[model samples]
Target: MNGKVLLVEDDASIATVIRSALEDEGFAVDRCESIAARDRALASDRYDVMLTDVMLADGDGIASIDSVRAACPQMPLIVLSAQNTLDTAVRASDTGAFEYFPKPFDLDDLVRAVVQAGGSGDKRGEEAEAGDGLPLVGRSQAMQAVYRMITRVLRNDLTVLVLGESGTGKELVAEAIHQLGHRKSGPFVAVNAAAIPADLIESELFGHEKGAFTGAIAQAIGKFEQANGGTLFLDEIGDMPIEAQTRLLRALQSGRIRRVGGRQEIAVDVRIIAATNRDLKPMIAAGQFREDLYYRLNVVPIVLPPLRDRVEDIEALAKHFLGLAAREGLPERRIDRPALALLEQQPWRGNVRELQNAVYRLALMARDDVIDAGTVTAVLGDPAEAVMRGRDDALGAALAAWLGDNAPAHGTLYHRAVSAFERPLFEYALGQTGGNQLRAAKLLGINRNTLRKRLGELQINADSFARAE
Candidate 1:
């Protein structure tokens, strides 16, 4: 059989787009527009693979997977959906789908999976072979630096502190560390400090006894316990509550944790991997974060440069994301030179995450064989016109507003707008500076003590900043 694929999608436009892409790749693409058509295709065809959307106009896509499996037991199936919840991804995996890509997936990932389907390390292959490294599609020097750090951390159990912008794949770096590290056998337990409610974070990190709180009906295991002997990825660690920070500091100091409602301390042997978009030194200086814990977690820091800083990787990354999207049944898509040039020109404030989103949007909306600059402009909305022309209809109005109103006619807009962007930068720089007030202030261009006052206002590193320089 010639790498046949069964694609079930309700949207004819999307299906047609996907078919063209796959056909170009030499796959005998079979499109089924509805559940009935899907059933008919399955009955008549023996496909090497199946790409199914999570929702069909006639019924549930998850339900259809079982039918596909019953029909083609050995076929590799990939589920494409907009749902991003862990439960949804887990359920798709549980149903025996080879992979579950959240909607807006890059097309490169899909193609890679197809290429690796019968080879070693395919998505559903054995645990030792199924490495979950970040789908960081690039070979640029910046990416090489990131890959080096990941490889280094994976060789052993080193406490890693990853610093990056919000959408720069900090969590992916942490997971890659786990997948590549000596402790790959253990579960990668991720806890987003900022996402958890302040009152519940402690209990979440350290399991509570049954009846510890109003909803505690059964004994619960905290993230520390779950990640025992594996990796504990604390995302947005800068946002961890002060009380929890104190507790976490003690836990890291002693390798033992006291459950929220229990008196006894349980020892855990977990490799800590923390990440944050914010700076920690300022938080430590302001006394919002514990100083002692900062040093403990800062053993090895991996800083991820934002997408704008590494513009060399745009074309490769965009094509990679587009390929993943197509395999997930969006539409077979290709970025023309003009579209790629426009992508390279954008100021990626949200970093790689934003670019992936834009490409996915373009793939869905673009109407022909190629995605040109017009399609990119339509989906990404022209930033220059949006910003410089003050066109409110432009999608990049915010960027335009910042550039036109604040940027002076001198150096680059980045240098001029650095102060306005100081919040995220200050938070990160201070953490990098280890909470020294005089040092943090000097780095940020304020007086040594003036930096201290701002840390207080932002509830950042007051103690670290207050330290003797």
Candidate 2:
């Protein structure tokens, strides 16, 4: 076949016209009236492009595009819509639509689209690379999985749900999807659901009329409307309010939304890619989230692993951050082997963001060109004495636990009383230094004289607590 096309439409007249036009252009066309038929055609044969209507008598047209893209990631999709609204176009585009045509569109226009699709070369090949000149970073298996998924989803627009911890680069993943997908030319509009106030989320997403609320001084375009002919990234989606979820679901389902306090429904063309750190499944179970909304947004789920779990990539990530910092004018910063080792050894509870902050701090504070383990400890470790004190406390607790189990209540009251005073004294000093007694005393809301007296009475040594500064 010179060009193979999957022409899906419920109206026989429309399908017949499209199929005839395609065949006349020396293309082989397969026609399907329903999603099931479309799937059968998809499974049995390969096509260069798929022409689908927005509404099917049997199932949704956009949903069908998602299903087809799942099996054939690189197949181009052109949406045919009678609705002819920006919302319909945006929705179509978001699902990786190659182009959209309104009802009564000329057959020549479609043929031109088909010809363009063919000229673009093989539809099945070419892993979608990022368009922003920033390639996906990280060599971890988790990042590799993300890379594969990004390639799969690049050819088509499928509502993508990116799940990851804070600072795990969810926005980067979303940007990659938009850059690699069919709508590469379209804009990427990112919105943080959690950042918007509860009262303004709806307006932020779906726009507002001039008089929608007290603060509505002018007619404002929402992220969805602005993202027409592009991608809309909703970050921290799990933090989105239930009321906003309902509105979002309605927009997703109907491909239309009324501006806040507006009577008319405005159309918007956009692709929705949402990211969140929280688990939406349990939220659904707890009735904090809607099950239907979850299903709609979760058509393509990509989970990003925390940095600690992908320890193999830590050094690479550190280098990447350090290079970035250097370019940003922090040229004096350079991590040595010992510093990298220290980074690798420490638990990264805060993930990538925390690491980025640490690198920035190193760049800002390093006394020499090469950042050593001591500098790493100075910037990252709890004030030296605090870390030591914390370690000592852990040891003391272990010993106490062993003694309690083996030796029992013998002289326990005096020892317990001693522990109580000693623990507070150490904790106070630690808190003062940020756990350094010299620094701690200044901050203890106390004079050094008083702090010294208390430490003496409690039998606590300040020098032993000093971090290896």
lDDT of each: 0.76, 0.79
Residue 128 C-alpha lDDT in model 1: 24
lDDT of 1 by residue, 1-469 (tens): 2478888877777777777777777788888867788878889877777788888888888866567667777777777776543334544654556666665566777666654552322234222222443455555556655654554444456688999898998887787667645687888899999999999999999989988889999989999999998999999999999989999988998999988889898999999999999889988888888888888898999999898788878998899888888988899888889889888888777789988898888889999869999888888788676444443445366557767655566667666565566567677667767766667777778786666666666676555534365
Q: Best TM-score goes to which candidate? A: 2
C-alpha lDDT of residue 181 in model 1 = 51
**Tens-digit lDDT track of model 2 for 11-37:** 998889888888888999888888888
**Could you say which candidate leads in lDDT?**
2
Global Cα lDDT for candidate 2:
0.79
Off by over 4 Å in 1: 1-134, 386-469
Off by over 4 Å in 2: 1-132, 382-469
lDDT of 1: 0.76
